[model samples]
Target: MPPTPIRASLLLAALLLTSPAWSADPVHKEKVELTAEAPTHSVKGKIKGYGTAEYTLTGKAGQTLRVQLKTNQPSNYFNLRQAGKDEALFIGSSGGNSYQAKLPADGEYTVQVYLMRNAARRNAAASYSLDIGLRN
Candidate 1:
């Protein structure tokens, strides 16, 4: 059955309000670069088949970063892991839709967005905005 007009309107409104960080399909989660010209990065996508959508932020040692995610679905959380490492550094998860940290080295850092305690059901559509930037 088709969604009602009011319901469709609300859905459209939500999608329109979401920032354009949602990446196209086949997102490369490890190739994010933040520059002086473009100091923030945002990606929007979904989690299918229990896998996470990955993103990377590059910065120098001692740089403070605040990364946040805004989502339209439930059970969406992100993990922050150091680059080239398998385990999440400091065992940290976003706890909700936000992550913050001070980088320990000058290199790449990984931010992984996932669903429901590390598992995503099939065809579950999740839209999210990732905001990564330096702390003021």
Candidate 2:
């Protein structure tokens, strides 16, 4: 049976409401910029509730990458992932707030800062400083 226009609209709305990504918080993305003479950059920002901040930086394989996060909220943490990938190379909640590693591939990497579910549910806000560095 062919569905009516109203029925199709209702179905679409339902699908959208039930989609896994629908409830996910919108991400704030920014490209990490560094001065030509400095290998490090510092960014300070604030986030509330389920908000997320993603910092993307490009690097070459074998280059060293360093990231340090300081936040007021204890539950706030960060994750490091390669571009277009869901799995994290480093999960700050489990690994602590500092991450230093040699790049495995030549591409963009994202450092995502977010609050844990418990804190986010309480509408927690965090002010954070993220220091990122890339060097040989």
Candidate 3:
């Protein structure tokens, strides 16, 4: 039996909604650089709609890593994850903006800035400053 036009449209919408990765948001990536004289690096950016910004840095296992975010949008948050890992070490929305912890491994780490789904869907814009610090 041929499906009705309404059914086809509804099915397409459902697929699109369910497959967020298939229609994933764009990500802007940057490397964090800190010289020997400075242990901290600060970066500023703006994210609109569903876009995200990713910052990558390297650290040792025993070093303490600190990340602080200041943003005008309440829904804007950051997540910290080790490269090649699926789980997040920190989720800023639930854990708050300031994070300090000892590194779990010696490798590359990523800090991702984004808005919550609700705010993202509304095409909201957020301006933020992120500070990354590393210490022994």
Residue 69 displacement in candidate 1 (angstroms): 0.5
Model with the higher TM-score, candidate 1 or 2: 2
Structural similarity to truth (TM-score) of each candidate: 0.66, 0.80, 0.80
Whose lDDT is higher: candidate 2's or candidate 3's?
A: 3
lDDT of 1 by residue, 5-46 (tens): 999999999998886744433344567877778778777776
Model 3: lDDT equals: 0.93
After best superposition, candidate 3 residue 46: deviation in angstroms? 0.2
Q: Kindly report which residue stretches of model 2 are placed more than 4 angstroms away from their true locations once superposed.
A: 1-24
Among all windows of ten consecutive residues in candidate 2, which has the lowest summed lDDT?
32-41
Model 2's C-alpha root-mean-square deviation from the true structure amounts to 4.0
Ranking, lDDT, top scorer first:
3, 2, 1
Give the Å shift of residue 82 in candidate 1. Answer: 0.6
